[model samples]
Target: MIRKTMTVLALAASLGAAVGFGALPAFAQTAKATVDAGKAAGTVGEQADGFLAVVSGGDAAQRAAVVEINTGRAAVYKDTAAKTGVTAEAAGQATAKQLYARLAPGQYWKPLDGGWAKK
Candidate 1:
């Protein structure tokens, strides 16, 4: 169990670095502002699957932003999984750890086995 935890942590670190360095696609970057706004408004949140979710019934714009951002994240996770010899789902879950750590106070987020909660 410890070994597995360590491995996941390492992968999270690597994925975080890639994301922090602006590795997301241009479409994701373009939608980031809207996503941020949604988060602040409690309409959007990060999921344990390394993608954004609409916590509330968000407007069309917010939902669109989430879709755009998630699409980019899916591509990044797939690429990282290939490079690191892990499954894409594993890569995404690892990245989700890093993402959860960065959540600001009052932002909503959901765990894999639970409902949404405020950070």
Candidate 2:
């Protein structure tokens, strides 16, 4: 079951990475860097709800970066949902599952189990 789920998530991330989520293109360089650092430091984590969240309190700048990334994700989710005949929340949830698998080791993720763990 775990292997199957991982395979599915990997495929989803690959496809979404190409044309859907647009996390790479949508996030600004500075915001992306901030998010990267946050993830590495365990200060922020990728949420199962398709948004970034602070695992540990961070400065206003870090919070702002999360907002910026989430805004881009929101637009992408809306567009994808419209094209796929799904709700934005559904699309976002699917994308979140995909993105969660993309997190590197030591980065934090909120899994479908509803708990945070290092990837």
By TM-score, who's the top model here? 1
The lDDT values for all models are 0.82, 0.73
lDDT of 1 by residue, 11-53 (tens): 7877775653355567666578889889899999998988899
Q: Where's the lowest-lDDT run of ten residues in candidate 1?
A: 17-26
- TM-score, prediction 2: 0.76
lDDT string for model 2 (20-73, tens) is 345565348778788888988899899877888888888898999988878877
Estimated TM-score for each candidate? 0.83, 0.76
Q: Which candidate is the best by lDDT?
A: 1
- Candidate 1 structure, TM-score to reference: 0.83
The stretch of ten residues in a row with the least summed lDDT in candidate 2 is 18-27
Residue 35 in candidate 1 has what lDDT?
Answer: 90
The residue ranges of model 1 lying beyond 4 angstroms of the native Cα positions read 1-8, 17-27
